[model samples]
Target: MTNTALTGVIPPVCTPLTPSYEVDTGSLTRLVDHLVAGGVDALFLLGSTSEVAFLPDRHRKVVLDTVVGHVAGQVPVLAGVIDMTTPRVLDHVDTAVAAGVDAIVATAPFYARTHPAEIRAHFRAIAARAGRPLYAYDLPVSVHTKLGTDLVLDLAAEGVLAGVKDSSGDDGGLRAVILGRRERADIADFSVLTGSELTVDSALWMGASGVVPGLGNVDPHGYVRLVRAARAGDWAAARAEQERLFHLFELVTVGGTRMGGSSSALGAFKAALHLRGVIDHPTTAPPQIPLDEDETARVGKYLAAGGLI
Candidate 1:
C-alpha cells in the first residue's frame, strides 16, 4: 500500500557491498540515512542503480531487509522486482512484500520474445498478485520492450499500474503519459516518474511527478535541490542545478574503454561514495570490474567540482 504519493527526488539507493560481494548492512544503513538527511521524499531500493539485476536472491533479501529496517517508515521504499517473466518476478514480489517494501517495481519480461499484448498481460498479472502498489518500470534498453504511451495510459486507467518509472528515454512517450494523466480524470492520481538523470528538469517541466535519478545515490542533496527548484517554478535555479548535476554525471564515463556501461556508471557511483566516506570499499559485484585508481581519482575530481568532496 502506497501511504504517500511518490514524488520529489527518490534516489535509486545504491547497495553498498563488501569486498566478498556480500551486502554491507552498515554502509547500506548509512547510505539510507544520508538520503533521508539530504531530504529525499522516498527511497528506491534494489533498482537497477542498486545492482538489482546482478544481485543473488540472498543478497537481494539482505538489501531489502536492511533498507526497510533502517528506514522504518520515514519514507516509502520501492523495491525492484526485476526478472525474466511473470513467475520469476512474482517470486521476487512476494519476497519484497514480505520484507515490507511500500511498493514493487517490475519491468517487462526479458530474455524471451513477447508481444505487446503479452506485456500488458504481464503487468496485469503481477499487479493482481503483488499485494502492494506496483510501478511499471519501462526500461526498453534492458527489457527490449518499449512500453507504448497509449498502453501505459490504458494501464494507468485500468489501475493495474499505480505509476510508471520512465527510463525508456523516450521523451515523447513520457510527455504523453504526463499530459494524459492531466487530461484523463481517471488517471489523475497515477504518478509518472523519470529515471533519466540527463533530462530531469525537462521531465519535471513536462509534468513528471518526480525523478528516480541514479546519480542521486552519490549526491542526494544535489537532486533534492534540483527537485525543489523545479517545483518552486524557479527555472533558472533548476537549470543551474541540473547543469551542475550534468557536469557531475561525467564521472560515469571515467572508467572509459575498459568497462561496460553498468560497470563504469555504477563503479563511478560507488567510487564517489567511497571518496565521500559513505562506504568502506568501492568494489562492485563480481564479473563487473572495479574502477582503477585513476578512474576513482577522476570520480573524486567530479565530486570536488560538484562541491561534494
Candidate 2:
C-alpha cells in the first residue's frame, strides 16, 4: 500500500444476519450498496460495529470475501485484525490480506495487562508481518489502555503505523495526536481519523483526516454531508447536521436499560437498517440480546425523524 493516508467518510460497515444468526449475504450486499450509493469513501469491515469479537473465524472470513468481491475495487476496504495479542491478530492480518483488504486496523493487545513497551512491541511485530498499511485502533473502552499521543506519534515516526482511529473519547488527547502529526514533516501523511462520531466537525477543525463513524452504517449520507460541509468550511451547516444526527443517535439508547451498551447500540443500528429495508433482520450475535418490538419501534421513530425510513 502507498503511504497515502486514508481520508473522508469510511464507515464501519454493519454485518447483516439472518434469523439463525448467520451472515445474510443478500442483505449484506444491499447494505454495501446502500453505503456506496450514499458516497462513502471507504468501507471498514470486522470492526466493533460488525460484532467482530463475537463472530467465529469462518464467519469473519465470509464477511471479508463477500464485501471485497461485491465492492470490486469501487472503494478501499479496511479490515480489523482485532484480537487479544499479537500472534492471534497476525492470523487475522493474514486472512484479511489474503482476502484482498486494502489496509488493516488493529487494537493494542488486550485480555491481559500489558505495559506500554509491550504494546509498542506488539504493534511493531504486526507491522513487520502485516504486509499492508497498518492503522492503530485506539479504542480504550475495550482495550483498557489509552494509546497516549506520544506512543502513537512515535510509532508513526518509525513507520510502524500508517494512521490512528481515535475512539478514546478524549478529544483533548485526540487533539494532541492531530497536532503532533501536524508538527512532524516526515510522517505528514499519518492519518488521524476520529471515531468520535458526534463531534466530527470539531475533529476536522482539529486537523483530523476523516471519520470511522459506526452511525455511518445507518446514515452514510448524513456523515458524508457532515464531512462535505466541514471541508467546504460551512461550520454552521456542519453543526446543524451534526446536531440532527445527534438526535438520531438517540435511538441507540432505547434498549440501554435492558442490555449492555454494545448490545443496545448494535441492536439499534441493525433495527434501523431492517426498518429501512437495508437488512433482513435485526438479530445480534449470540449472548447479545435482540431488541423486542417496542425497542425496535423506537428505532423506527429515530429513522423517520432522520428521514431515513
Candidate 3:
C-alpha cells in the first residue's frame, strides 16, 4: 500500500456485535459504508470505539480484515494498534499492514506511565516496520501517559509521524500544537485532531485537521458537516451544528463514562448506533457494561430529540 497521511474526520468506529456477543461483520460493514457515504475521510476500526483492549487477538484481526475488505481501497483505513509493550504494538502494526491498512493510529501505553523517550521509541519502531504513515493518538484521558506538544512536534519533525489525534482535551496543548505549526512554516500541514465532540468546531477553527469524536457513531453526517463547514470557514453554521450535538456529547460523557466503569461512554455510543439502525446490535465487549434499560431510555430520549434516531 502507498503511504498516506491520515486526515479529516476519522470515526473510531464502534464495534457492532450481536445480542449473542458474536462479531457482527455485516453490521460493521454497513456502518463503514454509511460513514463513507456520509463522507468520512477514514475508518478507525478496532480503536477505543471498537474496544481494542477487550477484544481477543483473533477478533481484532477479523474486524480489521472485514473493514479493509469492505472499504476495498475507496478510502484510507487507520488500524488502531494500541498496546502496553513495544513488541506487541509492532506485531499488531505488522498484522494491520498485512491486512492492507493504509496507516496506524496508536496510543501511548496505558497504566504504565511511559516517558517520552519510550513513547517515541515505541512509535518509531512501529513506523519503521509498517512502511506506512502513523497518527499519534494522544489521549491522555483514556491512556494515562501524556504525549505533550514538544514530544509530538519532535516526532513529526522526524518525518515518519504524520500527525496527532489530540484527544488530551487540553486546550492548552491543542493551542501549542496549532501554534507550533504557525511558528514553523515547514510543518504546518501536520494535523492536530480533536477527540472530543465539544471541541470539534473550535479545534478546526484553531487549525486542527479534523476530529475523531465518539458521538459521530450516532450522527456521522452532523460531525462530518461540522468539520467540513469549519474548514470552509462557516463559523455560524459550524457553531449551530456543534450546539445541536453538544447535548448528546454531554449525555454520553456524564459520570466520567470514558474511563472504565459500568456506565461506559463506549457502550452508550454503540447503543446509540444500534438505536439508529446503522448497526444491528449494541453489545460492548466484556468488562464494559451495557446501558441498562433506564439509561438506554434516557439516551434514546436525547437522541430522538436530537433527531439522531
Off by over 4 Å in 1: 1-4
The residue pairs found clashing in candidate 1 are: none
Q: What's model 2's overall lDDT?
A: 0.92
lDDT of each: 0.90, 0.92, 0.80
TM-score of model number 2: 0.98
* lDDT string, candidate 3, 198-281, tens digits: 878888877777888777877888998887888788999999999999977755753254345434687778777777788877
Per-residue lDDT tens digits of candidate 1, residues 255-288? 8989899999999999999899888888798799
Listed in order, each prediction's TM-score against the native is: 0.98, 0.98, 0.93
RMSD score of candidate 2 (Å): 1.0
lDDT of 2 by residue, 1-309 (tens): 465648899999899888888999999999999999999999999999999999899999999999999999999999999999888999999999899999999999999999999999999998888777889999999989999888999999999999999899999999999889888886668989999778998899888999999999999999999999999999999999999999999999989678999999999999999998899889899899889999999899999898986
Clashing pairs in 2: none
Model 1 residue 267 CA deviation in Å: 0.3
